[model samples]
Target: MSTSLLIMGIGGQELIVIVVILLLLFGGKKIPELMRGLGKGVKEFKDGQKEDSPTEKKTEVEDNK
Candidate 1:
């Protein structure tokens, strides 16, 4: 028999608990604004990382020459 290691498989109940915890910590009024800011921050960070990848760096050097 195959063995599985995951103890707490995430489901609807887990999501509801997570939402309730967030609501308690940040309150209902702030959740949307916080989530929006978090999304923007993650997007910008990923974009910045992608722009610095090796292929882009090689292109930048070729353009400068």
Candidate 2:
């Protein structure tokens, strides 16, 4: 299947419209700050996933024992 099919039928034009709406809503000056916050959120989510991985849990259990 094509990538658009995987995205539930949202194509390139739809993506552009969504980005344009975001830009209009947040304004150009605030977009960078919004993106920076989003980046930090993603980073924190990844870090949390790493901390909760099976290997980390196993190590914690061994340390406790």
Candidate 3:
């Protein structure tokens, strides 16, 4: 299992340091809000992709045929 940090050329220790820096910069209370926004953005992106999926449109057309 390759970690994304490794793909980005960062090591595990660098990941820890980055997390700690974020915590310090954003503080504990604000981190959850940031994560929540990130989650919502990802969910919205996935939903948008689903809405635009050509395969689903093709399937519907085939069913009507």
Candidate 2 residue lDDT tens string, 1-65: 57765679877787789999999898989999989999999999999999999999999999999
Which structure among the candidates has the greatest lDDT? 3
Q: TM-scores of all models?
A: 0.77, 0.75, 0.76
Residue 15 lDDT in candidate 2? 75
Off by over 4 Å in 1: 1-8
lDDT of 3 by residue, 1-65 (tens): 25876788998788789999999999999999999999999999999999889999999999999
What does candidate 1's lDDT look like per residue over 1-65, in tens digits?
11231345666677689999999999999999999999999999999999989999999999999
- Ranked by lDDT, top first: 3, 2, 1
For all predictions, the C-alpha RMSD in Å is: 5.3, 2.7, 2.1
Off by over 4 Å in 2: 1-6
Which has the better lDDT: candidate 2, or candidate 3? 3
TM-score of 1: 0.77
Per-residue lDDT, model 3, residue 11, is 86
- For model 2, the local distance difference test gives 0.90
Q: Each model's C-alpha lDDT?
A: 0.87, 0.90, 0.93
